[model samples]
Target: MTRQSISITAPNDHWLKAQVENEEYASKSEVVNDLIRKARAQQDEIEWIRAKLIKAEQSGFTDESPAEILTAFKEEARRNGDL
Candidate 1:
């Protein structure tokens, strides 16, 4: 575990205090760590989505009919045990 001293301003300081006072966090460090964790997770999701979009763009369009698409979707759901 690492300990560091950092400064925060007015409303942000109040927010941290409120989080600890409200028992949302055991300490201000917990709040900061949680925020960083959430931010990193969101960034990861954004990167995943970007990669998917690029892959789809590179894969080009499909010519399958709407009914065929629906059938394939249902088959996939069944295969995945989602149906």
Candidate 2:
């Protein structure tokens, strides 16, 4: 991977240092990498929720039961060899 020097604000730099020291991250790079990964994951989750909302709107679907959602997720996991 290509490494580039990017400037960060003082507050963010301090936060990164503290995260590295307190969060058991191996280094500042690891802390930054974790932050990036988490942010991307959260973004993907938001996109998925948005898509679900759009589909629900199109179908005029009502709210689903929690148990149904869990069962569906378990079934999907099994189908994907996650179980």
Candidate 3:
């Protein structure tokens, strides 16, 4: 494992200390690493949604009603195990 030397604000440092005291994490390093992992995952999800939106936009306007479109989307999500 690589060692890091970084500074954090008082509030952020306090939060990390609290996490360790609460036994939610083994150490500040673990808390920071878990947060980084979550942030990376969130970014990936955002990129995926952005790609999907771009594809939809490029497909042009649709004649489907809002409700119909939502239902279809939900059905597709279920089929893909996304919902």
Candidate 4:
């Protein structure tokens, strides 16, 4: 795989190195990779939630009982095998 060099300042570098040591990351690159993956996962979740909300709004969904809403969500999740 191709790699690129990134410059970090002292405190940020120190924090990253400390995290690497404390978390037992194999190297700084591993820590950075994990961070990137975690951030991407978070972004994906946000985007999914936003899309769901927009669809719900567009569908004119009304306020419903928490249990009913949850049941619908669980059914959808199970249908998609994502629960």
Candidate 5:
């Protein structure tokens, strides 16, 4: 694995230390990596939503009701592991 030498604020450092003390993570590197993974996943989800919005805009009006649209959106999110 690659080694990093980044610095953080006192509060962030304290939070990382607390995570280690609580045994939530094995080390600061692990915590940072997990956070990065989560952020990347969220970014991917955002991109998916953005693409859907663009396509919807291009497709014009839909006949579906708002409730139906919301339900379909929630179902899709669940299927994508975002819910």
Candidate 6:
């Protein structure tokens, strides 16, 4: 693996060091990597939502009312094991 050095604010540096001190992470690199992984996952989710929104727009309007849309959303969420 390649290593890179970067500068960060004092507060941010303190937080990273605290992770190690608290034994939540073995090293600052681990904390940074975990944060990066979380950020990447969030970005992936954002992109997915964007794509779905665009597709929904292209699909045109729906006749479903707000309550009906909520019901369908709950059902879909349950089916997907997200609820």
Best lDDT goes to which candidate? 5
lDDT comparing candidate 5 with the true structure: 0.82
Cα error, candidate 3, residue 16 (Å): 0.4
- For model 5 the local lDDT of residue 78 reads 96
- How do these models rank on lDDT, best leading? 5, 3, 6, 1, 4, 2
Q: How accurate locally, in lDDT, is each candidate?
A: 0.76, 0.73, 0.80, 0.76, 0.82, 0.79
**Model 3: what TM-score?**
0.72
Can you tell me which runs of candidate 1 are displaced by over 4 Å?
Answer: 62-83
Question: Candidate 2, which ten residues in sequence have the lowest lDDT sum?
Answer: 65-74
What does candidate 5 score on TM? 0.74
The alpha-carbon root-mean-square deviation between model 4 and the true structure, to one decimal in Å, is: 6.5
TM-score of 2: 0.66
By TM-score, the better pick of 2 and 5 is 5
Winner on TM-score between 2 and 4 is 4
How far in Å is the alpha carbon of 70 misplaced in model 4?
Answer: 16
**Candidate 3 on 1-83: residue-level lDDT in tens?**
99999999999999999999999999999999999998998678657756655566567777555456556766886799765
Deviation of model 1 at 5, angstroms: 2.4
Q: How many clashing pairs per prediction, in order?
A: 0, 0, 0, 0, 0, 0
lDDT of 2: 0.73
Model 1 agreement with the true structure over 22-72: per-residue lDDT tens digits: 999999999999999989986775566566555555566765554555566
Q: Model 1, poorest ten-residue lDDT window? A: 62-71
lDDT (C-alpha) at residue 62 in model 2? 54
> Which ranges of candidate 4 are over 4 A from the true structure?
63-83
lDDT of 4 by residue, 1-83 (tens): 66979998999899889987897797898888888998998678657756666576567676654455556766886799765
Q: Could you tell me which 10 consecutive residues in candidate 4 have the lowest summed lDDT?
A: 62-71
* lDDT (tens digit, per residue) of candidate 5 on 8-67: 999999999999999999999999999999999888877776676656655777766545
